[model samples]
Target: MPIRRGSDIGSPARTRSRKKSRRLWTAGAIALSLPLGLTAAAQGNASSPFGDEPELLQYEEQFLTLYETIKDPANGYFSDEGIPYHSVETLIVEAPDHGHQTTSEAYSYLIWLEAQYGQVTGDWQPFNDSWALMEEWMIPSADEQPSNSFYDPSSPATYAPESTDPADYPAQMDPDVPVGEDPLADELSSTYGTDEIYGMHWLQDVDDTYGYGSACGGTAGDPTFINTFQRGPQESTWETVTHPSCDDFSFGGENGYLDLFTGDASYAQQWRYTNAPDADARAVQAAYWANQWASEQGNAAAVAGTVEKAAQMGDYLRYSMYDKYFKEIGDCVGPSECAAGSGKSSNHQLMSWYYAWGGALDTSAGWAWRIGASYAHFGYQNPMAAYVLSTDEALIPQSPSAGEDWGNSLDRMIEFYTWLQSAEGGIAGGATNSWEGDYGTPPAGTPTFYGMYYDEKPVYHDPPSNRWFGMQAWSMQRLAEYYYVSGDERVGPVLDKWADWVVGEVTIGEGGDFQIPAELEWSGAPDTWDPANPGDNAGLHVEVTAHSQDVGVTGSLANALSFYAAASGDTAAQETASGLLDALLANQDAQGIAVPETRGDYSRFGDEVYIPEGWSGTMPNGDVIEPGSTFSSIRSFYQEDENWPQVEAYLNGGDAPTFEYHRFWAQADIAIALATYTQLFGAEE
Candidate 1:
């Protein structure tokens, strides 16, 4: 039977979901019901021959095996044939934190799948289906938010929709909630004073309050961006409650990254109501939409949409780097910047060095070539582009203080970049920058690093989130990349800080026992806040939100281990990676639905659990791991059914010709470590 996801059922609707799932148990059912059959290449290419390589043949077999279980093109999201696609009517736990459009997720995965699987199956079906979300969200006019700069854009920074109303959501009524329940009321109960998974339900609240903008459902109040003084930290986190501007003018808030966070706490706090920066979400959704393109629908539109989203991503990235970073003047910061240029990393200043420091290989400056041709819209990857994505960059001393260069990328390179930022972060939240060092806690009302940045105090965080510091490995990693590529002198110490911090924060024993960070109270015991000491970094724990033992802490440490050990001349770093790797190895599942018997690198097999009634049931707090649990997020939503084939293919060397599958920072680190060992210690033999 289809393994029950959350609550022995699926989505938010509990009735008969499992029963319907049971019908399409066998892989054969999915292949027969959906579009897994031999799909002819477009036009005259239909007669093209199938795979000839052994790797291709192996990957193809795996893909065919997943014929069933994967979502069918029945007009809904990832599902098998005739499987009722969950709509607003049938929601999985109150919609998720930031995934107002999970289809974007489908699209993102689809892009990865196409790069990894399409060649094996000669299929564009999956990629096409993933992009289907464009039909509803990615439109010329619909893309822009009301009063957003893209729309009216009166002055330099002023945006008409500076403050959003909480009562409005999803434009109008949504079936996701109870039939007649007041969306505002429902959302209030969800995000209000809580950082639990349900807190994300605030997404709908923000959309209703603010109205969906161009960066439609991309990200909301992402902590990484929110913390930056560039955006002016003084703005009221709660759009409905306050409107305080540092500068005399508006901040074109609806555009760029501001629209990611929700004004209301009841909905998915990460559920971005606005959608101005449309590239990321759209590409992600296009990946999911690709699976459903098995029909006569040629996949052209989907591919084109995917390409378009990539283009937009490229443009936005350049805008962010050249224009936004170099030129923009905010209240807290001025137009003038560090003379060191790319060599700055103490704070959010890391963004400017994205060309050489940030892991922009996949999105920022080098996103185009890193992704593919359609992705070349970032003008094109020059010298620094390839450098950030690889060790070949020669390690420049862009930032003398931090050192290290070339972060991570999405080209199957590393998992740290992806997992460290979002693994424990829950599927519905915003991506974070880096983890907090020394396990410090934010003061009360100062926004706990749990997830959101503006709301720094865990006290203000009613329930408090666990996504932030938990997944901040990304920052350190990109810095290391910067050092490796740019040859910057600052990287040595910066790498040490990250490496040491990872070991200090996350440690594993002989067994799979993980030692998460527990900040020494000193003054602040359980809570990190202290009234006595003014401005002391009381306490912060990214582990606060990550409850699962799977990816949250483990994945981050693994990523840290990989990067720290990959270069550092220190034998201790290598030892740290080894110990962590051992624990990861112990958790491997041989017959797991996701990938094959994984040996060596753990990236091949991410966290994929087959809990019988675990997720399929209710939450301890009564809230379901709706939308999805952190477990699902780890594997990039990879499960045994259809997507696993590609995951397996990439993992087992069946598909990964180049170590590109090491695209994820964490995953790439593992690859880099292995490559290093092979060079020094020689092959395993």
Candidate 2:
């Protein structure tokens, strides 16, 4: 059952004032307190331990203040086990359904946040601790996946046809469908001396809100691995049927949730986990920065252990590059027609949506499965992580082929960006080996990346994955970072065009008000790739259909501009980044910077969840699941949320409810952006 509002069920909430006057030190006060030489440094005369400008000192103060707020026990940003929650507020919903439910994305941000902290304060303990916390809680232990030793390289997983509609499931598992070999399994196991994967699972019910207990039979209140979004592209978070990652007959209907998603003659109690490669890659990116900053501070040994672990994670992340079921890549019209791949033929050399592994709970059953994703989104590629994993000796993977694979991936990723770059500078959606997620035929004239078909929105389509402006900011920020570090000539022109377009969309008004691109509209598609003579993609374009002061995206945009400006010496990008940081600083609350979000999507609370007729189940909380059940009806605990009253009112003819959510990822992004600005452009100019 969900923990009741105001109950002392999880972390204790302490009272914190929203006012900043009590927490932050004024610039005048900071200047007055500094010694003679430090005061001169503040006046832009000489460098101090922080920096040589008052603005830089101010940014450092802002970062420290924000970091403290995030770390404060009263804020409830973290669980008792030291794992960060998705948000401080428990009554919100987004990609993770419940705010208490944590994601690997949040953990990656935590790692990055601490790395920035280490850079600013010359303290690496927090950075190391953050990585340790993620490893301990997010990554499944060996015991949680004991049957991995039974996995076979020859056959990965049985094939199931993917559908756009939730009603089309339970997709039948067809063993007759051919699958390719798992080339990395034996090598990875041999290198690590363990069959178990070292990657973090994408989602976790940190407070056991769903009462699924824990993986491999632990009690409630422990962090429980869970999953959603299994139906298909059309299935939104509202349409999901939440189920434990480690399925036993103890919860849900007979056969657990397996029968609800995939139709098989029988079901087994099993453990499954999915890795969001972008998140793991972000963690590695953070490690690379942490190593760089610590080495600068003469504290390289402090983060050495965590950096090594990040390399190992990157090695395992290679799974995300392969086609789902390891099917041969490119130009396949049917599931069976697509030949099973023997080795690297299945590898896309780009980060895809996810890679998953699973096995039976009863080890004696001796069956396990692994599969990679076929779709590659432009937003998921992290060239910085790829560069570090491939080139940085301190962070190179232990596996022999891992570095070479990443080196190839880095080149492929850059080329992918070039291929997808729109006439207006925005990157378009990505390519898929198995079109429509099941090797379906693409319409004639649909552009191809290598042999793969281009998709306007590769993964989820509930909102069209590329429809949000955040994707541009997040992906381009990594590109900007790569350009900053590598100074690659090919990257400069791409960054110049993108940074110009982004700055054109931004509008910083008087006072603290600002507008950045929010919703986006896309038209036209890129021309088919010819690597020897790449197409100009002049027909592809993106339009900013909406604008808002979304603090998180603004932070990301600011960070992107900071790196681009630092590398290209663009004063416009630098000034715009400064303005954004200043705007964000003005919007501070007790928890972190946030703007009020009107959740019009809450109307989907009453949306019907498609359950087959005569098929029934019970949630762990005892809510009945049947054909008539709505999204909120099956997860009745949501009704117990303190904010549910407003949602109920909205459902009963009231206005849409609004919330100022202090999401962990958003707060960390904002804080890290501040530190980034100081590091890059905070010098006296």
Candidate 3:
């Protein structure tokens, strides 16, 4: 994701992730090492649309494994779509991990996967199962239900009290809610080990959820059933995946895709078609699409296209998004070190997360290419995943002031992308606001504090300019989704790695609320902060009471995990997705946010909040999922407003989005989630 102002400038010297075995390129290098392109017809073959290479098999197996973990079963509710699912009740209390299920993430990815391989084999049991749980429980409903997700413990369901000091470290489970009487206090588990163990446990929950063999009971009232979250996968997510120039194409057109009038072949062609069917290709293309749309599609065009696309796709919430793509890196993965611009942190992520999608704005992100890579795969309310991914890149430059340098890869700006999460599923670095402590010493500005609160109580807090669990929301999820749709190779590991981190942080205790071990604290110390100051932001703080950083992260990982399991055939990812699905379902509001239109099984979640306003923003199509407004202003996310209906409506796919503020405020990083998530979890979500 782009920096939150005051970070290093330009790109940071990245850590190399390759070897030195390939033959050296002679002065006359013919770009010969690349593989041959697959024909359009052959591209979608059953043997992996990307083709017969060894890597395809590897990814396929991985996908299968993840799928197995999350696929629906026969023991619980089933969706007419033939997907299996478990009830939030059992999913939460019985499951020992993965309480933070990402509702919106699951739906978007399932739609894309079905679009791609439906005919050959289109049973999204994995996605469906996960979706069922999320829909049933995770979202905050008017019924005042509580999700197993620790992020927002029980705003509506139980109505427990929340915290007022997000800055406090080493939090107890119930900062506000009375412990013994709390609704989920008994079912929620505890996070009592190294952050890694906590994450692994959550991962285990995801595994178990998918392993359940019961199919979702029905799909009758599923709110987003008819919404075209993804386009026909038969066609390349871009214009022409197999086209050689695709490396340069920027998905654009009257369709939810992209077509920069300048006509760069599908910049994503290089991405997805590096054979469009490949994961790497998809990741790269998604980034290209996102960048192109934002840069070339003027605001008026963007607004019209977004609203029209939402209508066409059958979802009022599926607006426009920054694709999280770029033209420079077309279809190839970055070398151990990324290309100058391809890997260079762009500012669009910060500004775009909150402003796109008419009045629907929210964001996601893992790190770096957050907005530039994941919008399509993760930013779906409709079939325009590719377009939203593209839009992510366009909104960077306008983020709130005092932002960090896009490329700087440490502390405030660069930390979260490649870094790990804390015991409570919290991320670290300088997000939220800048100025306090080292955060306040930006090259040109001061930092502000942005911590999470739950049930009206504080969970984690960072010093001014210091963010511990902060991330680029919309962008992070979008990048992961892009990896799946565009078929980018790096998509696999990227998604996996990040998921691992988030899993360690978000988990349920034996009591069922959520937990964060004290050992995971890496805040305000020499190891955490720079030595010059001997101080950093607060430790990695994740809580279940109010808004937790994991709300953005856990959801993104789960969504990607579901998809990757589908693509690579990985059971682990599948299981993880299932656990997340269940948790999210238990926490959701039946008719709020993403209300199931029909009502069988499955419901989308999240509230609408513009970028630059809150810590996280909505998807690229401009649907606000998270809360926003003035990062440092405690009142921003602290107040209890009457936007509940808006949140539900948007989550279930808004019918009337007001895209008047597609101007992401530098900090909202939702636009860049996919790329970031993909960079970590492999192809899962």
Candidate 4:
């Protein structure tokens, strides 16, 4: 049975505050002591934290209120389903299946908050309540099916919808509508449309391509692949969009990775669909911490069970994912084996990379020809994998009998990192030997899909993939954690290299703004705001710009760098983080509510529209132009309209802004960073 609120069962004996001096930091003191170029109203300072103790208390209270507001009381987690406001009051979820990470972050923050209170007041009340949350919501009971447990099985793979018929998708009101050139038909289908195990409840209306393009849901003109049946086995689903070569794997298995995806092929696909290792890494990390909490209470069973879960996740990441790739595909081969431009670690670098199942098939192995044609490793997914492995050796567990010892796991990470370090002092997110430059005459015996040979050079490989600063921030954070846990001096240099790059490339100057670079080059870059415009380095920083700068992405990096600076004594890294936090605070909406506006990277609904293809012309005032515009120059609704402020008003003690585009991550990341900063630096000293 699910644990209920007010239940005394999980509460630990309460104690008085351990460190009275640290109990509360006044915001007023922080405002006075803050260094130059820093904003007093942003996050609090390390010394005395948030200027006033009440501000910090208020921050916590507001967070809890928002958490309770958005949480699905039924399941005891934040709901990503339905309209954006209906779910979280702002920011609609483009893919509900992918929204679990945001919810996981929410829970993680709650635990952090409770832990903070526990450290400060010696009060176990908040800690006990938060721990109860995990038991009541995260853990699956004995009678519960593994599928019912939100935390047990990994994320379900998402499929492009196959139906275009309006009648078949009655769940979506106004299904047959069109947004400009893009038809709403593709929005109605799903990659899981053929699967029986997944019902309509699993597919949210906003799941399709965030309401863009015909390829989002299914083929616009083709009807052969329309989703007609729902209650069938694995055989009913289309393994590939058009490929006959795709084979089916046995549906059920004891393997975590296999079982999570294949056990129900009706709900599974040939490939893993999710991106970013944050969810997977954070889930295991939370489990580790939960085990620590359980151990403190002498709950041996809970401790063991949580550890086992964490280790299992590690096994899947290590053996099935990271290790398997490294062993099978070493870094790089000679030109005869690899493409022309292939280097030492190019092939084996990005262990965290992943694309949706059959996405490679859908794109016809568009980028990487030899290996990448089959595997579309992403840059954002692996740092957390490194984090999980480096978190604890117990979390590492024993490898398969045939597999090597646990130390090799860290060794693998070192190898991956060596490949990650670029000449420019930054870490690139992904690298592939798919291009002719990566591999000349493709390896023999390569698999074929959709009547296309994986050996041929594809147009997608001509221009190499660019690094993502957001992902690098994740890597930097992971590196910090790794240093903290392992106490390995080696990681410090790595941190310096990446941190230096961030300071030099991403930051405007010593006390200026932080900008995330777009994936494309100068002319083809995504549209975003440039703080340095009209100054010394005016006109959009293309080579060193990001899609958008927000608290979630930037604050995450700040937290990680803070940890690194603490561990490594890197003052430059610390200074950079301070500047970043200042920038984050300075970007708040009218209500002192800070968050990231949508950045232009992939989708362009609220961020930036593709010039002539999606829109055209300038405003009557010539202040805004659509076509031939860089992401920095384009104006978006997020920049102009979004500010709806119920949560902000409640938390910050002010009225809600008129606009609305809420992102829980922004709040969570900032809170996490602030808490970490307070813990590390807050004191009477």
Candidate 5:
């Protein structure tokens, strides 16, 4: 029998495993240096579409390890409840040494992956597991909240709640305040050290419940608003509050976690709110498709449930769409300072995260300035969700905001693409919102929040203004889908423009020097932000330079271009897409190493700081490399000395970082793109 890792249970490709080898690019230059051995296709005469079935299966198994790693076998669910999960179960302690909680974005990724896994193999376990997670832990408790009745986590099969009563959850309330005060305002004040805004008694829960509270309280059925009686006369002597239902992600609160002071003297406070459009969008997509999968399995309830769940999220996402920023120094500022205009205007602009407290936004009133919007991703699935919800009117309870027409979704996409398309014919990676934090003074014409105790004067870094091919490629894929679905005449030209953009950006050189510059800089960057003050944009303007192509960006482009070509009947686009695919295949490891290149996995592990003026190091080819040194005044490499040797060797060999280190996200991006490519165009070249 051939060597097996786990669950290998004899595969036909196993017989030819010994013969498999890959041709690696030589260390010196981009040229192919030496012949290693036979490729996977040559070794097994593989018949699977994407590449080798066994190899892909192995990669899948390896990728699933992270999920397993984060799982709590004892608890029978994922670990890490606080600061991440909104489970009312008190025994569910945070997983030891585990990664960050997969609340907002990871939920969608897992949903998408589960569907893909089920499609490939005749197994619904992954899909079932993913759905169970969404049903059990992700969706907020809706027992008390009528507005959040769309996705109820009341099923006994998947979720076993320790306490069903709303009064059972552990929370504190103030006795002096009235009973009907706003829970959201009180919660925000208590959490962020602000004045108690509401006169009604506030139920203060832990961080885990913030997202749930934001969802439940922001919406109508405030399940998290536990009704408590006063136990004592003093203000702090109110009875403990407990949630009637588990509410998480039911209402869209973009902030993921609290921004605690890290003791960094230069920064007063830094609050980062993660709003991954790609993750959230894909989750919606998964829900739309998962319903179809469920229907195929003869689960009508699941079919309806999935669509309703997706619609709920889609509704929440609408609140997060581009809205006017409050300009009254602390009010909703529209037309002039909408969050959409503050960032680069991608047609469907979706930000992964919005950082506040660092002077990124005008937060003089408080750090919780609610300006909703995110940077855009190409494969936004909100449109699909809208279509599904609109078509299946009876299955899901329609909200005026949630049940918006498909036209609304299309317009969002149009807006994103409009903002994303650059003058350079490439789509930027969205705007970088960085301001220097030194200047305590606010800029002229801006409202000042100087006296607020909890609100700290924030300084931002030099704003990121550049285009990323990876993001552009992903956007192209979404555009292609939109065109295919709507056949909108306007989208056709935009699609063609993006196709041409890809052709210009993606460069295939001599001896398989296939590469795409990772990023292109903005036209102008102010050189010096007020470094003297340290809290404001002093006067720093740095332009971004390009970096080498990686598998993720290339894979996305390959898939998008393939879609565009097929949709438009553009032969040139088709040819370019084919070449890109061929290049990707050429780069694949025959030995079945799933080490897809990512930009930043190994570089983060450095204990020793390697800060240089210009070039970090030289390649074996006698060529100096400066990866994004233009904007960066000083180069810094935080590398662990012991691990540097191995990492350096991998880099020299033009190999990607190790899989175990960057599993969830980096793994998913490439896997999803490639799977999508295969789905779009079968192996028949």
Candidate 6:
């Protein structure tokens, strides 16, 4: 039997028993010798794709070494069920709030990693297996979301006013507030012949560490669907109250965890999921490369099924293009005053923060809801995936309108990037149709994109969403890829300026000691968008506030520079990219390339968690949740982690904890960077 099948049409049972031969190569060993498969023919003249250049060959060896380290069971990158964890360490906290927990972002990186591996080795099994694992574990099964058939298109979801303060929630769901219709529901269901969504949920408890168990009700220890970040724009991962996606009223307060985020007359056992569109788009981006590379090797058929599934995922990702409540796009102010949308009026045509859906757990309830996000972050846009979905015949979505939608999205995204570009060449935060996430009015003279208002920080405010330099690298890498593929004149200037700015900030010191921009500070905002004659954005600018040797961001930065160099023939970009890759090679370890990080944010471990007064609950492990609870008090699991002592000391007024983290996405990014360099510029003599 095939090792795994695609989940485009239907979900499949976990097929974790399949095994592939593993290559065992030490990082130190590979540095001294050529990678196993390279031959003289593979290293021919500059015209050859895989050149014999010593630096390129060394990068290939580095790629193989990182690949083996990631795949080696002893390295602990993968869980028992083959799902990749967010990071190898357990006590760390970031977007997912826990190191063991995984996100769709990590799954997408795994797919990208395997795709590069396939390109290098001509073996597609690992690529297929990674997608299968993502589908089996990250995407919820039919049983997990059994009532999607009950979803209504005309009325998507009730309006719940969002507040920046966590204390102000349980936001009441107001039925009187008008919401617009879902434009894609009927077509998507009809195209697939199933009401179920063919997308992965944004987050998952990979080890079932929170004890959410399976759909409806099941045992713990299996990978389970989970969610966080409910309170609003100001709610960071630190303030979130984690809960199961499939709440059965078995944990939390009387209404499970629902009442904590949204309030209604009553509540029922339910299942819900949020889709991070950027991650799904990246998976499609990876699949496009996989198909191109596989076809080059006369092995296109090996990954055809998975590519189809990626297209299916892209089809559903259209939900991210619409307004949160389908409100008419552009200058939508006031909740009731903002006219509800019809057809495509609500479409933002740019990738938003998230789209979500849910339904009652009871089979007979016949009620479900879906919602799109109103905020569009520049960092999440992927024109490369949009190009693939709109143009690739075999990879185009099945829905009749998907091609048109993605085509529009591709154009809109480029316009968005152009509009948001700052004087310093970095992209600004984003724009939103609903100001303050509630259709509130923006300050006077705030610039707008189409109808959406410019926001210095789009989604969350605790840590400004665009403050991380990693976002610039990730988004620009996609733009670079699109440029490499299309050579579109619109993208060339954006890449030129961005490459110059980022390359200026990168410092590759001797012996792999280097620093790239870490935290960024933005000043000024782009002028209102004018597609016919775009503004220079002379007033908008960015400053590098801090710098660090972030391994993952370095890899992504190198990837972006290489792609830009490949298309534009920028020697500066090409040299800097090669330098960054070479510097990273000096930091390799048994698990992966990484650097020590002093987590000063660990002090937030003691930060208070705002629970409603007179309301209390217990976690599955019997941790208490009440008004006085702090973040560390909730789960009580972190104290048991091997790295807990350092965090505990930091929480108890000691120096901040330092950890050498081996994040799955970081390892994958490093490997992909090496492979990308080999493919893009390796042939150069």
* TM-score per candidate, chains pooled: 0.37, 0.92, 0.27, 0.50, 0.49, 0.92
Candidate 5: RMSD to truth: 18.8
Badly placed stretches (over 4 Å) of model 1 are 1-77, 80-312, 318-467, 518-553, 588-685
Candidate 3 residues lying further than 4 Å off, grouped into runs, are 1-58, 61-102, 115-520, 524-685
Worst 10 residues of 6 by lDDT: 1-10
TM-score of 3: 0.27
Q: Number of clashes in model 2?
A: 0
User: lDDT by residue for model 3 over 516-612, one digit each (tens)?
Assistant: 2221233321123232443333443434232332332444455555445444445555545534433332332221111112211112122111221
Global lDDT of model 4 = 0.34
lDDT of 1 at 1: 5
Give the backbone clash total of model 4: 41
Model 2 regions more than 4 Å off:
1-53
Higher-ranked by TM-score: 3 or 6? 6
Clashes of each: 146, 0, 337, 41, 67, 2
lDDT of 6 by residue, 56-106 (tens): 666776788788889899999889998899999877788887888888999
What C-alpha lDDT do the candidate models reach, one value each?
0.25, 0.83, 0.24, 0.34, 0.34, 0.83
Q: Give Cα distance to truth, residue 462, candidate 1, Å.
A: 5.0
Each prediction's Cα RMSD? 20.4, 7.4, 23.6, 16.9, 18.8, 7.1
Mark the 10 consecutive residues where model 4 has the least summed lDDT. 5-14
Q: Model 4 over residues 184-290: C-alpha lDDT tens digits?
A: 11211122121111100111112222111122233222111111111111111111011111112211122211221112222222221222233445545545544
- Which candidate, 1 or 3, would have the higher TM-score against the true structure? 1
